[model samples]
Target: MSELLLNHLAGRPQAGSGPGTALSDPVLGTELARVDATGLDLREGFAFVREQAGAALRAMTYAQRAALLASIVKVLQANRDRYFEISTANSGTVKNDTAIDVDGGIYTLGFYAKLGAGLGERRHLLDGEAVALARDGSFQSQHLLVPTRGVALFINAFNFPAWGLWEKAGPALLSGVPVIVKPATATAWLTQRMVMDVIDAGILPAGALSVVCGSSAGLLDALQPFDVVSFTGSADTAAILRSHPAIVRGATRINIEADSVNSALLLPGEAPGSDAFELLVKEAAREMTQKAGQKCTAIRRIFVPEALYGAAAEAISARLAKTTVGNPRNEGVRMGSLVSRAQLAAVREGLAMLQRHAQVLHEGAAHALVDADPAVACCVGPTLLGARDPDSTRAVHDVEVFGPVATLLPYRDAAHALALVRRGQGSLVCSVYGSDPAALGAAARELADSHGRVHVVAPEVAASHTGHGNVMPQSLHGGPGRAGGGEELGGARALNFYHRRAAVQAGAGVQSTLA
Candidate 1:
């Protein structure tokens, strides 16, 4: 055992068994920490958050909560270097990937802080404008939005422990809801440390924010009617969470971001070596390799013109070939290992299933680890598989291998490509690359119903376009159908999740007073 990372209950550390679940570095296989919530009354935690922290936060205005968020940003910034060091040891990530989780979190918190400042001193939100309930001047109606009286429980994925916690917390805190985060066990170290830093700062009220680091056995059962649960993980797990008795009984609000086979489509007008073609290739390769393709929005299916399929495959493979995978601290290493050995095994198994229907264009398994032992290191290079007859392969469309892996599919034309992309059921994002504005607009409109966001990339914006898989704080980050019919991160719209709406019908004078 290295260190016992206790669960933070009501801003106090709750110690568990001396030896708990061991967390190790994926690359070096050295124990980093342990987490256990052996004997804590979770139901009391829910009550503490609602009665204590929730009351304290609700007493403050939006601007006051925003100021608190700003103070947290400063605290996180002061300890950023230490966070980076821990990310390398626990997350097996280099500087760039760690920045996405750490700095990205701080950035989101700061953005929400500035946005909340504009909301002023209002403790509750008004929805739209007041309307007449009757023809007479004496009657009126106004829709009101008030913060829920319970907590927000976040069940996050292992890939983004930091960004996952803050992005959701920023809006919930602003909405006057306390938060309890149960980070995925694999990468709980960084999440635990970040919470430790915040608690040490003493800026937040006790129970305003808490982290449960061990098993999530009884957390869901403690939910009250006003409580909300936001989860990020595989579709299977999302389905399981949905069927939990509390959620099934409508005693809690649930939001999910599940498996998505997101795509990148190169429009038919673009030919080989053109700007659109090159941009698609670059983005596809980057999405496949960044964070070791563990991102929920990573481009898993690449759609290009049938005539230019070979060119796209060769170009993307060239990029993946240059990426070196090993221990994140090593020089010249462009990518790091999977979060754990279990994840590595899962990716390999999924790849084998997809290979039954597709050819391996780039065999990442053949690549050797640069600075870590092959047997101990949980490493895998970027892989590009090609499904020549994509229309016939079910696994290529349905299975999401959460690693540095992607499958290239050839489309006959724009319509053909759209049909193939829809086979993904639904996704978080899909980028259509082309040079024509009219064509790109048409494609984007067609994809709007299936994808939360349709990123249209052209020659003009290629230089400035954010990469395909990068989830920005200012845009919608969830999708419909298999991707989970939940929404998040669309500016102030995200605050709606923490609010309860009601139509207040009253006399004109009363309505005016309430407003």
Candidate 2:
């Protein structure tokens, strides 16, 4: 049996298992108890989530709830080191990179806490004024944002177990709804630790947050119309879940944030020998290596002016060659391992497909690392490929090497570049590199219909740009079409996903009759 699977089976606690032993994984460096079968049963889990939503709403006033949220932030800060350790062990992220995930996640919680406070204070506005005496001498009209009685089931991807969960939970919790999180097994340990912290803080109601490890099993089968489901993972799985009979027959509300072949474009004015050329290389390299290229938002396609195709290839290759790959714990280790060996294999498969339509400019598949275990962990060197033809299936689209991999496609013109990017159908993000405002605006508008978010990066804006791989709390995280037809963050936009909006009204004489 695989080490991961063996560890999973061994970690299952007996009914009488002692406290620490019941939930501890010596290999993974974390203690997380598996949910009792009774607690994890779909029906019971649903009931628990629903009841917690009510209790969470009743336990505190708006101010008190906001205060509880603030307390969560403090707790997360104090436990930051512990969480980072868990992240590194389970997800292969270095402490520095993992720290960003923890910090950003904490910020998300804090943002929603403030949002909850704001909503509570402003809810009175939603309570529309009761107009005095209608013609029949009766009060009339009212409006409010009430919580949905159903639960929220969040099925998350392996890349971001912590951030993804809180991103969904923060909004739902603030909106007075309960959430059930199912983290990917490979990195479930990190999520378990964070959730335990929340539970121990005594901020959330008992049932406000519950977690399920291992397979989803019967979770989706019993969903109701009032329940809300959100997912972040591959497109194929999203399709399967979306087409489930229960989801389709009962019309359950579902949101998906899947993977996509995202791209970036360099304008004609930026030849390879120019400053713009160097900037493009740096940007693409960063996208390929940061988070070990695990981000769903990373730029998978690089479109360069055909005249400077060779220059662009060399520039990117040179940058990638210099990147150091090893254990994230080691100093100066710029790139780390993929989340797991399975993920490394998946990325290799993606590169194999790209070989048909592109030429590899740089290969880091074989390298001697100073200190890291390849068997227990896996790391792919950064790879850069040049598309044989912009219009080819493997050139601008139809492939995504999830690890530190990128393809450079040469476009005949701006129009052709836009066409190549659009072939991917829809994506989470597309970035354009150029100093000309007209060029940036033109490319952005042309590709606007094809991408959910477009970021313009030029020498002028480069200083302030957050780069291509990071997604902020206030921004929408999902893309269109193949990327998943759903979004995760967007402040109140995410909160509304857990709620059902119904326009309630009564007959004009109803109010008079009641009085």
Candidate 3:
């Protein structure tokens, strides 16, 4: 075991294994750390957050809360080197991919800090103008927003340990609610380390931020009526969480961002070697290789026009062939292993399901090793498959191979492309590529009906546009239907989740006094 788990209620870095689990490195297949939160009192932890941390945070101005976030940013920046190394060792990601988790977390906090400062010191947020209840306006009602008197329970996915935690906690703290984070068991080391750092530095009040790295044993049982739970994972897990007694009874609020079969569409006019076509091919390969394609939002389906199907397949295969997979620490390695052996098994199972309808275009095979054993590491080369009959292929549309894998499908026209896009049921994001802005925008608009976000990658804007897989802090990150139909990280709009909006009915004198 590396060290004791961090339990905020037990005064940070609580010792003793006490029936726990070991976290192993995906690249080296060695024990990296241990997680055990058995001794923690869930009831007492919840109580401390509600009575102490919540009270202290509720009393502070938005500016003060933002200052706390800024302090957190400083600390994370100082320790970024250690975080990068941990990410490589534990998560099996290259420096570029690790930056998406570690530096992305820091950037999100910085964004929230500035946004919180702009919100000013008001404890209550006004919603529009006061409503008139009488002809003379003596009686009126004002809709105001106040912080929830409960904690935020975050059950994060394995792919993004650092980004997932801060993205949720930043808004909760700004909205005056405490946080209890439960990261996925496989790669919780990075999250545990960050939480320990925060607690040790006294960045926030005790109970304001806590973490449970192992099983979420008694955490959900301690939720109250006013609490909120944010989860990111598979659809099956989301269903289980949605059916919890507290959630079903409306005692707690649950927001889920589940797995999605996100798609990338190539317009008809773009030829094989054109800039738009090249961008589409490059982006599809990038999404597949980045983070070993473990991202929930990674493109699982690529839709190309029927004319460019053969060329598109060839181009994508070439890109995957050039990608280097092995230990992330090596300078030449472009991609790394999956998070663990279990994840590798899961990806292989998913690929088996996908192979029923699609033929392998590029079978991901490791060509070189960077001072690591191939059998021990959970590495998989980038794989691409071609699905000629996408209109009737059920597995290509539904089954998601969560490793560096993608399926290529062909569409006859714009209508056919849109049809295939909708076949995904719902997705977090989809992209359209072409030379004509007018055509691309119109098709993207049609595709947007089934996607949370649609990026129109015209040749003009392809250079500056963020890739299809990148999630920005300023936009909505969740989608409807199979994508979990929840919204998150829309800048200050995210703070709404932790606040309760109520309409106050009273006379003018009462309204004035309340203000």
Highest TM-score model number: 1
Q: TM-score of predicted model 1?
A: 0.99
Give the per-residue lDDT of model 2 (tens digit) for 430-507.
Answer: 988888889889888988777878888878766788777677777777777888878777766766676565433555
Which 10 residues in a row give candidate 1 its minimum summed lDDT? Answer: 10-19
Tens-digit per-residue lDDT, 1-515, candidate 3: 46656555523445434857888889889987888887677787788878888999999988889999999999999999999998998899999999999999999999999999988877868877898999999999999899999889999999999999999999999888988899998989999889888888888987788888787877878888899999999999999988888898866988889979999999888877999899999999999999999998899999998889999999999988889889888899998889999999999898888887789999876456666788899998888999899978888888888888899999998888889888889999998888887898789778777888887788888779988988888987898889998888989889999999999999999898656
Better of 1 and 2 by TM-score: 1
Q: Per-model C-alpha lDDT, please? A: 0.91, 0.72, 0.88
Number of colliding residue pairs in model 1: 0
List where candidate 2 sits over 4 angstroms from the true fold. 1-39, 58-64, 122-144, 273-275, 373-376, 506-515
Expressed as tens digits, the lDDT of each residue in 1-515 for candidate 1 is 47889888865778875468888899999998989877788998889988899999999999999999999999999999999988898889888988988999999999999999999998988999889878875787799999999999999999998999999999999999999999999999999899888988998999999999988889988987889999999899999899998998866999999999999999887878899999998899888888888899999999998998899989999988889889899978889989998998999999989999999999997788989999999998888999988888889999999999999999988899999999999999999999989999999999999999889899899788877887788999999999998899889999999999999988987887765
Query: TM-score rank, highest first?
Result: 1, 3, 2
Per-model TM-score versus the true fold: 0.99, 0.87, 0.97
Clashes of each: 0, 0, 0
The per-residue C-alpha lDDT of model 3 at residue 21 equals 82
